[model samples]
Target: MPAVTVDSTLELPRVPVPPAEGTRQRPVLSVTTAPRGFEGEGFPVHRAFAGVAQRDLDPFIHMDQMGEVEYAPGEPKGTPWHPHRGFETVTYMIDGEFEHADSHGGGGRITDGATQWMTAGSGILHIETPPEHLVLSGGLFHGIQLWVNLPRANKWNPPRYQSIEGGQATLLSSPDGGALVRLIAGDVAGHRGPGSTFTPITMIHATLRPGAQLVLPWRADFNALVYSLSGRGSVGEQGRPMEASQLAVLGGGDALSVAASARPDERTPDFDVLILGGRPIREPVAHYGPFVMNTREELVQAFEDFQAGKMGAIPAGKMPHTAPGEQRPV
Candidate 1:
């Protein structure tokens, strides 16, 4: 859960408290638990956005909370070569290392609160895996992979990548110094994060001490959501109870609120959450498999292009394999 941390919240810039008058508090419209699942080379994941209406998640496509699991030596895993189009993949590593390389010449190793943001505009081929050493000696691996959809106009924009180091995140605190806010992207109280996006969105990882409350000013045009990453907490000022792996869809408002419970689980120690919102794309979404497009015809074209090697060839000598666990070092 340590995406990023500060020695003391009091030293961070404070997020001004939303004024009581004229500011409407965002209300929790619904809360749904993310169902457990597996992803990329058989690693565990929680389908965080499962069951939520796509309309409510406009401008955002899919998200997976990857492993809060501890892996034994030689047990860590990652995805083989894959293709994507018409969206961006934002991978934030909370506690472990992940190596990413794409056919378009974007690659890097991210770990311990760092982030790798990849835009699959038009199309591209890529792979995500644990570095060789991490695979040889498995350790804690936890992270988030969020799929942000591009609008129809920018669907075919050139692909891009951003490797935002953990320290590059904009750190802030709640008015009372009871919560730590790690702004990974977009603007919060005019404070900006490192990652850039085709679509306007805000991504934040926040941790609250037991019984602490955090209120943040939110853009009225953007749709809001609060996903609990660990421990117990409440969403909205009215205090709708939420627990680990739960996703809360919030209704329109000028601001949002989250509060940690007085008694949190011993395992997590604090209430951790991901606060996300984006300007609604509000277009006809025709998503299938790895392609997010505006029409079925476009999706078909995407597959055809990928099969024809139009996306980009894998770098010389790269081959699809399960993981280093299958080929241990001597």
Candidate 2:
């Protein structure tokens, strides 16, 4: 008998392997009620997991949701030039426009449904404010800003920036057509997102129709959380319900299940949820004002550098327009 070799055309029956025990456990969700904090003088913001004890939200140091309030003409205010070091800043605009300028000669405009990710590796001075048109005419302003910490090894890396338009994001819809997820980073439904990240992280802006459900897979090592932006929703296997402006911290698990509440009397029929997670950095965090570093000495150096004009100043003139093809630095 001749030796038989599996032909290239041979199709083998595939068997699914069960996930390891303990790894497949459904996550537990706990609601975290974050208080309001003012930024840039008057901008009201809700900080998720605020305070030192809650710093367990690693990789993700801070998360802020800016005003859903409508600004009257000439009342729109924004942060002036400030310095940051040793981390990254992510800004997502839901409505209105934000003009930004950074020390690396990086400047651009992010409008509704757009995003800006800036890495202040060593240090960078930047300004983010509403454009003149919006400042004068006034309009609704709503957005989110997240601070992602960098490992100590990469804290002094060169600064970089990236901007992503809403259209460029990977949008995935559920099979039942009741849930939609806009992936800014990481993966969803086998589709990757547009943003580049130093660490493994997932950011998904999800919307669920009334009474709809979504079961999303997540890495077991990642620390995950769900933030309710609007309406109401239940998360995790325990069905922990959360309302608007609340944060749901999740425990170790491989998957998360979320469902939007059925509200007949509510004007908004859908629920908005922001799901974020990242692998822990597990390092010391020494932060002061806009600077975040692993040591107090490094934090001091950042301030000294900014005062000594190390971080270049924004040019005194009209805001420069971003050229085509310009992308955020990786």
Candidate 3:
């Protein structure tokens, strides 16, 4: 995988990974895309729809922005079928709808500005596509897809879904400049979001008015990173602009500090930030395709089970309840 450039103007900032010699300040790693996602194109990848990795910034492995731009009808717009395991996949949309189905017995459609949280526990097979709603409108389709790893104890637990409608997400006013903040998983300042979580996690959405500097709190031991969806601000005395479709891999803070506010009487530019952080898994991360486990034996078991045509990703002997009439002949 080649390193995806965030911007030459933005300097790199890095904190030491665990078990290193000592506390150290390293240069920031540039953003990069996965090899397969390149569509066989050569290096120096283009930035049409790139997913930045917070893996180095925090502990996040992959963060892909699916729809920053709109799509027209019959324009070949959709994410072809794919697979996932070992980590939790989170899909959040702002403008257009996304269609999804999986070999794991979970399938549904999400309208624009909606979010779907899928935990690919054990071994699950899945795919995602754009909904027909956008086909009719021929308007824009945009959304975000993120991958979060599970702790060693819970990696093979079971796959589950938590869908949050655009209206269901909790929105609150910030302590300063009246910025709007939406909590998706954890609490911020005093505002709590409505999304369910299987791990100790914090995911929030924030919008800053021009010249407004808003600061958000985070844990020191836990890893956290901010994906700039839109707008500009100084990240703790360092002037960094969080523009639409770009990301700001942050550094320097026991508590994550960021500022996005309206300029003195100046019209506020659109600014959106996704602040995600959680307890880092100190264990080794063995990722192959989608299944994340501790060792190669576990990864091989996952593949063998998939080849045997196992329907769901949940562990054996534990089947979560499904809606009536959902059970069908195998």
Candidate 4:
């Protein structure tokens, strides 16, 4: 794998918002629980959302919350090389480190609070593995990976990569110092995230202090949902309380409010949440394992490309941390 860097002083463009003088009217539609499953070898995960049979979550096909579990020494595990096409992958680390390498000569590392956004346009093969040191020492490994679907027109665009450090994420706090919002993509409190996307979307990792309240604006047309990552919280006007690992699917509205429930004798009384959504693509989707295409023919073609060695290959045996660039199709 090779080191990928971004300009330290680069500025992300912000999404405009109207004045915030009036009351917000967002509503809670239903709540859903992400089923648990094993992925990438034996890594345990929670399937927060997916697009199966129908495009339930358009512009976004899948999301998985990697383990918050602790690994014992000599028990390391990770995903081996795999092929993908027609979408982008966003991996956000909450506590652990992950090294990634792709066939397009793109590679990087993302650790605690950092993010790796990879565009698997057309077709590409990649692998994600934990560092060997972690395997020996044993520690907590937690993170989230999202599959953002590209519009039909941009599905074949060239593959690209962006690596953002945890410090680079925009952090916005409430006026009363009760809540903190880490904007990874889209905008929050007029501050934009570093991620560049092909579709209109927003992703915010928020934490609210006990009994604290926060209001945030969102586009009316975007379908939205909030997942309680940790602690207990109430969402929308109904004050429906939810515990960690529960997801609240929200109805269309201009804005949303979230509050954490107070807990006595708790040292760190904070509720963590992941807020995500985007405008629906409303187009037909054909998916097969790692590949997602608008048609079955394209999906089959992706498999053919991989079998024909068009997606490139990872060198045999131990891979170097950095390697010479490989030629790829334009």
Candidate 1 lDDT score at position 211: 94
- The best candidate by TM-score is 1
lDDT of 4 at 232: 79
Comparison by TM-score, 2 against 3, better one? 2
Give one digit per residue, the lDDT tens place, for model 1 in 164-253.
999999999998899999999999898998889989999999999999999999999999999999999899989999999999999999
Instruction: Give the range where candidate 4 is weakest over 10 consecutive residues by summed lDDT.
Output: 1-10
RMSD of each candidate relative to the true structure? 3.5, 10.2, 10.2, 6.0
Tell me the spans in candidate 3 whose CA falls farther than 4 Å from its real position.
1-59, 261-268, 311-330
Model 4: per-residue lDDT, tens digit, 81-182?
A: 788899999998887788888887777788988888999998888878888898898788888889998889989999888898888887776656677677
Q: Per-residue lDDT for 1-330 in model 2, tens only?
A: 000112321132211222455446456546777688878736778877675254558888888888776889998877757778899999988778889988787778987778899999988877788899998999888888999999988998899999988877776665566776778998754678899988779998887779977777787888888988778878886788888788888887787777899862274577888899899999999977888899898877877787777866666663533221221111
Mind giving the per-residue lDDT tens digits that candidate 3 earns over 1-330? 001112221132211122323323221233232222321111111242245533543345566665445445654255433445677888787666666665556667776556788887765655555555555656655556667777778877777877887667666554443356666777665556677766667887766666655555555555656666655554443455444445545453455555664542232264566777776666677766656677899888766766565635432322222321232111
Candidate 3: worst-modelled 10 consecutive residues by lDDT: 1-10
By lDDT rank, best first, the candidates go 1, 4, 2, 3
lDDT of 4 at 185: 90
What lDDT score is found at residue 119 in candidate 2?
Answer: 94
- Against the true structure, candidate 3 has what lDDT? 0.56
Query: Model 2, poorest ten-residue lDDT window?
Result: 1-10
Model 3 / residue 325 / CA error / Å:
27
Note the Cα lDDT for every prediction shown: 0.90, 0.76, 0.56, 0.77
